[model samples]
Each structure stands twice: as structure tokens, then as C-alpha cells.
Target: MNRMQLAALATVATLFTACGSSSDTGPQPVAIDFKALVGTQTFSCADTAGYAIGTGTLPWIPKDFRFYVSNVRLVDAAGVEAPVTLDASVWQGYGVALLDFENGTGNCTGGTVETNKSIQGTVAPGSYVGLKFDVGVPTASNHLNVQAANPPLANSAMYWSWTTGYKFMKIDGLINRATPFTFNFHLGSTGCTLATPGDFTTASCTTLNVPSASFAAFNPTTQAVALDLALLFAATNFDTADGGGAPGCMSGATDPECAPIFPKLGLPFGTTPAGSQASFRLVTK
Candidate 1:
């Protein structure tokens, strides 16, 4: 009785150990790095002036730079994709994240000391050869009340109000000239309407304005995503302020100033077709 009982217990313990070992490998942490750049050089908040940009190569003082990234996915060598389940935190939550490049220094007065430089999350344990994500918050997440929203969404600097929803991206710069003026590129969904006067939960926008990108050769460990301000403003005139929604593009469908900028975001404005998104590109970390 003693020999048989001991032998049976040892066999059961071996099976349990093997099961535990297999179950231990559930998911792996995946982080895709990103950077804000002004062409070849990495961007810094201390540089207040003299960044060459725009059609005429005019100098401008960079003020603010922040944007959201969502629906992150990792792609395999054979083109199969898997969504990265984002870890909830102050900089990321509810399927969205704020990639803040400003640190409240120099001319970036509206920025905060805190900054987030990467999309942090986990994916199914496998080999990923590429990355893909959206450049804005989704509709269900975007059309909610900011006061009642979660982490990154509650960041007032990245928000507008109830009716208009959150700003997808906010990049501003003051044209360095005799009559210096601020050019705000506040992008969000426009042509929205709420069933009730102040109920943002009921708001529906005609234009979603969310741009997407897929990098076929991205290696999360050895590469980084670069958001190039120089490429963004390449086709835009920094000096001119069209008589439209704001001094610069405000995601307004009919704003002439927004027409050129939206295409740079890989978004279509008015009747113009969507141009290739030149603002985002790959770079070595």
C-alpha cells in the first residue's frame, strides 16, 4: 500500500509541474518606441527658435507637440497581425495613449513636466517584424465627457470640450517674424452635433479624422517611430493665417488652412483625396 501510494503521488506531481510550466508562458511585454523629430535631428523643448520648416523654409518657434496613438498591433513576417493589449496607466488607458514630447521648457509653455515617449503594452508571445497603429482616439472613446473619462483622456491640455470631443493631435508653433503669430494645429473630429445641448455623450461627428499607418519592417527593439514636424509643415505656409476656424488647421472640413494639413495626416479634406502620410516614418533608436 505504501509503495503504490507514493509512486502514484510522484506521477501526479510531475504532471502538475509540466502543466504549470506550459501555462507560465501566457503573454509577453511589447513596447514600440517613438520620437518627435525635425528632420534628421531629434527634437528638443529647449530650442525656442530657428527650426527651418514650411514651403519657404521659414523659421518657427515650436510651442507644443502631443498626439494620441491607438489600436496598436504587431505584425509577423508573413503579414499576420495581432493586437497589443495596452496596459492601463496615466499616459495610457481605455485603448488610447498620449505621446507627449514637450516638457514645458522654452516656448512650450502649455506643456507639462511629464512626458510619454512610447506605446507600452503586451502581445501574444511570438516574433513581430512590424508595427501598426492609429493616430487618434476611437469614436466611442473620443465622444465621452472628459471630466468623467479615464487617465490620458482626462488630460485637459489634450482636450477641447464636450461638444467637439477631444483633440486628436495638438502641434503649435509661433512663426518667427517681425509680427510673430501662433499657428495652432488642433486636430479633432469636426461637424459634430449633440442631441442635447451640452451632452457630449450624444455627440456624433461627420468626420472621424483618424489616420492609420502600418510599418512593414518595424522592429520594436531596434527601431523607433519618428513624427516629423518638418514633413508635416512641408506643404503648409507658416506665415499665412486663413480666415477660417482658427489661426491654423482646426480639423474643420471647409477650413482652407486645414485642407493641406489634413492630407499630410493621411486624411482627406473637402474634395481632396488623401495623400500619403509623410509625418510619420521609421528611424533607428
Candidate 2:
């Protein structure tokens, strides 16, 4: 009555242990948060810089700041890419999220009063040595019909249409003169070709200015990614207007303002700038 019963109970216990171990071996889901900043200051439309970019010396006052990031992933020490799943919402779609730091006050009329301070997503739980992502929508989702696209893309302020595609990063502000003049930087693909305006098909743009980044240290739990506005506008003159009448770069190849910004974003000048990225930092708390 004892020996056979003992053996049966031992076999059942071993099977249960094996099943438990197998179930816990897969990757666990983790949440990662990204915070935006201008230098060390918490980014806000109300912030102002005493001086403008370059020698023209227009008074700088931040009015609006927003951008998009996509294809987010984490890199382990062994150099393996860990895929992340983004939370889908009005501000997020096509594997990307739109970050808006502006609240439509002062000189910023194109933005909303509500602001988005952080971006949250889920990734496999692990110690990540690096973080990688794109600055704009990829070609697969970039040139779609804006009316039919996701909420982030459908917004008229972010999309220009089939000829121009989406605005990758929009940093707008006022450079005070007799009146407050606008200094806008709308980054996106340029020189696109399509059969017609109404066609929903994708166009091949000569410059897909989707700059990205790879950081040495990125842990969502302990670090926050920052975008420094001071460094970004250092290369441009806010007072000077180019042939197009805009104060700052609009991803134009010939725009002098774009030269310094290209390197900052890790993109090659006068090219598509597809595989280039730089301009994300990890801040430890």
C-alpha cells in the first residue's frame, strides 16, 4: 500500500514543477516611460531664451514643440534588439507616438491647450544597454491619405498631404521683431513624386528626414530620454528668412539653417538621411 503510492505522488510533483518552470521562462512585459526636456529645464511653451539663434539676434520665445518617434526598441548588452509594443491611442499609431510639449498659448496657434509630457510603451523585461527608434513615420505609413490615416497622422497640423507627407518634428516659436515673427522648424521627407494629388498611393521622396537615435544607456525604470532645444537651434538664425520665407529649416536641402541641424539629428546633408540618428540622452534620477 505504501511503495506504489509514494512513487505515483513523486511523479505527479515532478510534472508540476516542470510545467511551472516552463511557463515562467518567456519574456515578461515591462513599461517604459520617456520624458521630454529642453536642456535641463522641463520643456514648456512658456519658456524663453534671452537671445535668438545666430547673429541676427531675434528674441527667442518658445511657443510650440511637438514631434514623433517610431519603431522603438531596446538593445541588450549582447546587441540583440528587443521589440517594444506601443500603446495605441489618438496620439499613437503606426508603431509611433507623437510628443507634444506645447499648450497653444502666446504665439503658438497651431497646437492644443492640452499637452503630452511623456510617452509610455511596453517592452520585454530585461537590462537594456541601449535604446533605438526613428524620429518620424516610416515610408510604409508616411504617404497614406491623411483623412484615412490614424489620429496622429490624420491631424491636419501634422500632415501636409501626398506631395509632402507628414511632419516628423515640429518646433515652432516666436522671434520678436516689431511684431513677433515665427521661427518654425518642420522636419519631414521632401521632393516626393506622385501621379496626382488625390491618389492615396505612396510617393517616393528624395529626402526622408526621419532621424533616429541609439543611446548607450536606457532603462525605462531609472532613466528619462531628453531632447535639448538649445543644441537643436544652435545652428540657425531665427531672424533671417530663406527664399521660401520661412525663418528656420523645413527639411530643405539648400536651406542654410538645415546644415547644422542635419548633423545634430545624425542625418546626412542633401540626402534622404534614412539610416542616420543621434539626439537622445538618458538622464538618471
Candidate 3:
């Protein structure tokens, strides 16, 4: 009961130590594939229709589509949160990325030759259950001068100015049967304060307007994140403008035009939405 028992116990202890070290060591890096889609269809610069979104039945031909997302996170199967490491590039900087599907073609006159359809990043390998991200730029970076800001932030089309900051999201299209013939949806932080025209040390916006999106069972590798424009406008009449006379929602709290669209953007009539209520849907391709 002495030497044999000691040797057996020693072997078991060594085995347990090895297993524990394996579990605690660094896991392999996971490649997260981010894709943007419109319903089941692939969203691109080309013309497509049959978008039966809102009660109104006007066919939509997309001319431009772009949006910003930051603080991207993934919840592993173990319920551990892991932030994504964005690939360094013009379209991505400071943990933010701009998803641009338009390539300055057709009616996309305000765009450029380059377009970013998706963004890829790395995370610690694990079985992820959900994904979370913010729709707009954080307060610290929102008020910076566009010319001096990072790549995507420096892009003029995305910036309203140093005072107003950037456009969180922009989706524009032509409504086939609408009277106005256009549907433009732009979202950004409002109610911002600046000491001067473009002051860097401006006060935080009353309406931060950064709606957070969370997805359950979102696979970072096999599945793609989708934003269905049809659902976004399912209740909107693109042909008509609100009392404020905007063709579509433009992040204005009082704009009646935004009444139907704001909820979809995770923003209510006059307040930011709860973190869990995002308008974006996940699509697998």
C-alpha cells in the first residue's frame, strides 16, 4: 500500500495538471465573418425589388446603403464576452467600421469608387451564442474634426461636420410608385452641444443616439449579420413626407416621419431604446 499507491497517485496528479493547463492556456483565434444582407437577398449596388416591407407597397431600388457599428462583441457558449479586433483599414478604425454597399454606381452619386460590403475580425475561439454592437460612434470620438479623424471617420460623405459628427447610418433608394420617388433614411446622434462652430471639447449629446444591437445564437463564423431594409420600411410610406417635410427619417425626435422608423433603429419617439431592442436581423447565406 506504500510505493504502488504513491506512484499511481502521482500519475493521476500529473494527468490532472496537464488537463488544467490545456484548458487555461490560450485558445485558438476565431475568424468572425461579418456580412450585410437585405432579407434573404444579397444586398449590393445593383437594382432589385419586391421589397414588401411596410404596409405601403412601393418597390424599392436601392441607390446607397451604409452604416457604422462599433464595440462589436461576441458572447461565447460559456457566456463570456469577447470584443472583436477590427482589421485596420480606411473603413475600420478605433473599434468602428462602416459597412458601405454602394460603389458610386447608378444613383449613388454621393458615394465613391470604394465600397465596403462587410468587415472581418478575430476573436478568441469558442462557441459563441450572441453578438452585440452599437449603431453609432461613441461620445468621445463623435465630435472630432473629420479632416483629422481616422480613415472612415475622415470620409466627408459620412461626416455631417465636426459639430454634428457622422451619419450613423444611411440607406437611400427610389420608390417606384411613391410620389416623391425617393426614400432616404439617415441616423445620427442629435441634441449635441458645441462651444463653437466645431469645438472639440463639446458637451455630450443629450441624445447619444447610440442604439445597441444584440443577437442570440449568433454564430460569428458560419452565420452573417443582416439588416433587412424591407422590415425597416415595412410601415413607412416612402412617397409621403412627415409634417416636418423630410422624405424619410433623419434622426429627428419631432419629425413625424421618424415615428414609424425610429423604433426600428432602436430609438423611440424621444428616447434611446433599451439595449436589447435592435431593428437588425441575422441572416445566414
Winner on TM-score between 1 and 2 is: 1
Which residue runs of candidate 2 sit more than 4 Å off their true CA positions? Answer: 1-27, 48-56, 162-164, 195-198, 239-245, 271-278
Provide the clash count, candidate 2: 0
As a whole number from 0 to 100, the lDDT of residue 4 in candidate 3 is: 72
Name the 10 consecutive residues with the lowest summed lDDT in model 2.
16-25
Judged by lDDT relative to the true structure, which candidate is superior, 2 or 3?
2
Which residue pairs does candidate 1 place in steric collision? none
Residue 85 accuracy (lDDT) in model 2: 77
lDDT score of residue 47 within candidate 3: 59
Candidate 1 lDDT over 107-134, as tens digits, reads 8897899888988777775556778899
- Local accuracy of candidate 2 as per-residue lDDT tens digits, 210-267: 7878875665556667777766765666666554634667777787677767777888
Top candidate on lDDT is: 1
Clashes of 1: 0
Query: TM-score of every model?
Result: 0.87, 0.80, 0.80
Residue 242, candidate 1: Cα error in Å is: 3.3
List the lowest-lDDT window of 10 residues for candidate 3.
16-25
